[model samples]
Target: MSLLEVKNLKKYFATQKAVDDISLSIDKGNIFGLLGPNGAGKTTLIRMITGIFYPDSGEIFFDGKKFDPVNDVGLIGYMPEERGLYKKMKIGEQTLYLAQLKGMSRKDATAKVKDWFVRFGMESWWNKKVEDLSKGMSQKLQFVTTVLHNPKLIILDEPFSGLDPVNSNLIKDEIFRLAANGSTIIFSTHRMEQVEEICNRIALVNKGQKILDGTIKQVKQDFKENLYSIGADSLPDTTGNEPYEVIGKKEQNFIVRIKPNDKPNDVLQYLLQQGVSISSFNEILPSLNDIFIKLVEGTETARQFQNIKN
Candidate 1:
């Protein structure tokens, strides 16, 4: 089931259409990646979803009902790219306060905060102020506060910023745990490799519009170059009538693209008939980073400012 749905959502600023007619559905228990380059309106779309900004046009549905920003806000946990913690406040107190704002009672919030602090090995820093912690430590604290209320939908933008590998893995594990237990996560970041590893479904937005949407595997297949890697000691010279064209070589593997109207079996058969000793064969799919660049390349590196008419 879809936990959140945005239908033809549009949000405009005086000089830019921040989000323009974008639509997407995020299913329950999905780690969905919302990917885009700078000025791509990802932030604007997320703001609308989290009730921080109201769409100028179109509808948003939360759990199948029309989104009520006032009441539904509590059901979402948003950790923006910019940290929102109070510099002067004690970590423990600030966490409890934020939890209460999400509708949790004081007693429950205290217990929950303790549990998370202990889980993240942050028990000692509770009395410390946010200003005193390093960037990575502060990031861990912010993540805890975001999910303290056990919200059904969680939005994390650049959640891994500034963390070392160990801490990054720590938070990554928590994100997976949250999704496994039924939280739907909207993960926005510029790290394509991380997106490929963490997200099952993704939507790519550029210029305030959604340009691609599908499961990671589906998107890869859609953009595959029909190239295959063949593990062989030596390749037979192409006689110009071969079913595949040798594109390149990597170490012991020969990279080839199957000719149109030719199947993998046809290539294999042709190779075998030539007495080529094949060890392994596998198709090579384009990486998300490759696809992302292929789709967004040639576009202006920076979005130009535009005039909007009322």
Candidate 2:
């Protein structure tokens, strides 16, 4: 079931269209990735979703019902890119206060805060002030407070900002655990590798418009260019071009692009006839980063060409 849905969402700042007629849906228990480069209007769209900014035009539905900013806001746990914790407050006290603000009872908030502190190995830092902690420590403390109320929908922007590899894995594991238990997550980051690691579905926006949306596998398949990597002691030489093009080469390895209507077996047979020794051959799949750059650049190039034509 879809936990959140946005239909024809539009947000404008004077003459600037920050979010231009965007629509997306998040299913229950999904770790959906909202991805884009800097200034791609991702932040604007996110603000609208979290009720921090009202859309100039559109409808937002939560769990199949029209979402009301007044009531539905409490159902979301948002960790914005900017830190909002009190620098002067002690970790435990601040955590408890934030939980209470989310409508959790005092007893429930304290118990949950203690449990989370223990899990994060910050039990000893309970009385420590936020200003005294390192950046990574502060990040963990803020994360604990964000999720303490156990909201159904969680939005984490750059959740791994300050942590080293070890601590990053710790939080990654916790995110997986949360999804397993029925929480829907919206993960926003510029890191493509992280998105590939954790997100099942993704939406990519560029220039205030959604340029791509689908499962990771589907996106990769859609962008595949029928390229393959092959290793051989020697390759047949047409220098100019043949049934396949050797687009790249290093030592005995070659990256080949098969021409339209040409079969892989035919290429192999041609190499065999020429007595070329084949070592290894595998299809080359495009990475998410490759696809992202390709789509965004392709859009820009087309826009430039249109401008020139005018």
Instruction: Give all TM-scores, in the order shown.
Output: 0.98, 0.91
In model 1, where is the ten-residue run with the lowest total lDDT? Answer: 235-244
> What is the Cα-based lDDT of residue 155 in candidate 1?
98
For model 2, residues 104-184, the per-residue Cα lDDT tens digits are: 899999999989988999999989899999999888888888888998899999999989998899999999999999999
Model 2 TM-score, all chains together: 0.91
* Runs in model 2 lying further than 4 Å from the true structure: 239-242, 269-275, 298-310
Q: Of the candidates shown, which would achieve the greatest TM-score relative to the real structure?
A: 1
Best by lDDT: 1
Q: Write down the lDDT of every candidate, Cα atoms only.
A: 0.95, 0.87
Report the lDDT of model 2 for residue 253. 87
On the 0 to 100 scale, the lDDT of residue 289 in model 1 is 98
